[model samples]
Target: MKIGYARVSTGLQNLNLQEDSLKKFGCDKIFTDHISGAKSHRPGLESAIEFVRSGDTIVVWRLDRLGRNMEDLIRIVNQLNERGIAFYSLQENISMDKASSTGQLMFHLFAAFAEFERNLILERSAAGREAARARGRFGGRPEKLSNDDLRLIKTLADSGTPIKSIAERWEVSRTTIYRYLGKLN
Candidate 1:
């Protein structure tokens, strides 16, 4: 049996094209999801995986329709393989069953390229951060309390003002006050 999976990023997107392709490809049953691929929990995909048997094959309209990223794609393919199932991507024309050596090679090559791409992205990100830091810029939210606020806080704390009262006046938590005082010391 061939089980098909179709997905659209949002509820507004149509699933017709993917469904038609899957049906034409001879899918016995098709499961569909109308959610972002980045989301980890997809009920339709889970059901399709659970519904497959040992001799079953899973088909998708495109490789991206099945997974959000390369890592996810590799994981899904590995899971299908472990369950004695085959995976076929219609647009890519790749099949991962025992008979297709070319398909297996292409799958591995794609996985490797995906990993390489991820590493390059990480490296570029680190470099960008370093460049920003060199210009005295930093990431994350700006400080909520100004230098004047810090001075007032330190003075009030020194005068033995109640921590809760200080926090309430500043519209902040007691922990925030403590953290500021710690930084002062």
Candidate 2:
């Protein structure tokens, strides 16, 4: 059996391209997800892995779609390899069962590149946060309550006033009050 896997990072992302490619390959089944690869809770990918069996082939548009990082890709590939399941990467034109030595080398090279890519992303994000902090913009969410309101809340709580009543008077939910109190704690 030939099974296909597809992934996109955002809910608004379209899956048509991957679906069309899988159909062209005559995949017996296809699993897809719009969840970011950084997250481990990809329902579609998990289901696809579970569905695979010995003698089955797993098809993917690219290796990166299989995981967010090198370790993840290697782990998943090892799992499939152990099961005697072949993998076919359409874009790379590589197959686990038939790959030449050079092909295998290139696959690992791609894994290294994926790791490099993730590191670059983290570096950029960290730099962005530092820049924001330098600009005196690093802080929690934009103010949801006025200073007076927060002071009133603190005072009410200090006086042994029930949090539920304070929340009611402030027109906020109990969860919101608790969240605010967490900052104080």
lDDT winner among the candidates? 1
How much does candidate 1 score in TM-score? 0.80
Model 2 Cα lDDT, one tens digit per residue, 34-90: 989899889998999899999888899987888677778877876787787778888
Question: Each prediction's TM-score against the native?
Answer: 0.80, 0.56
Best by TM-score: 1
Per-residue lDDT over 1-185 for candidate 1, one digit per residue giving the tens place of the 0 to 100 score: 99999999987899999999999999999999999999999999999999999989999999998888888888888888888888999998988874478767866887797899789989999999999999999999998799999999999999999999999999999999999999999
Every model: Cα RMSD to truth:
2.9, 6.6
Off by over 4 Å in 2: 98-185
Worst 10 residues of 2 by lDDT: 98-107
Query: In terms of TM-score, how similar is model 2 to the real structure?
Result: 0.56
How high is the lDDT of residue 65 in model 2?
Answer: 88
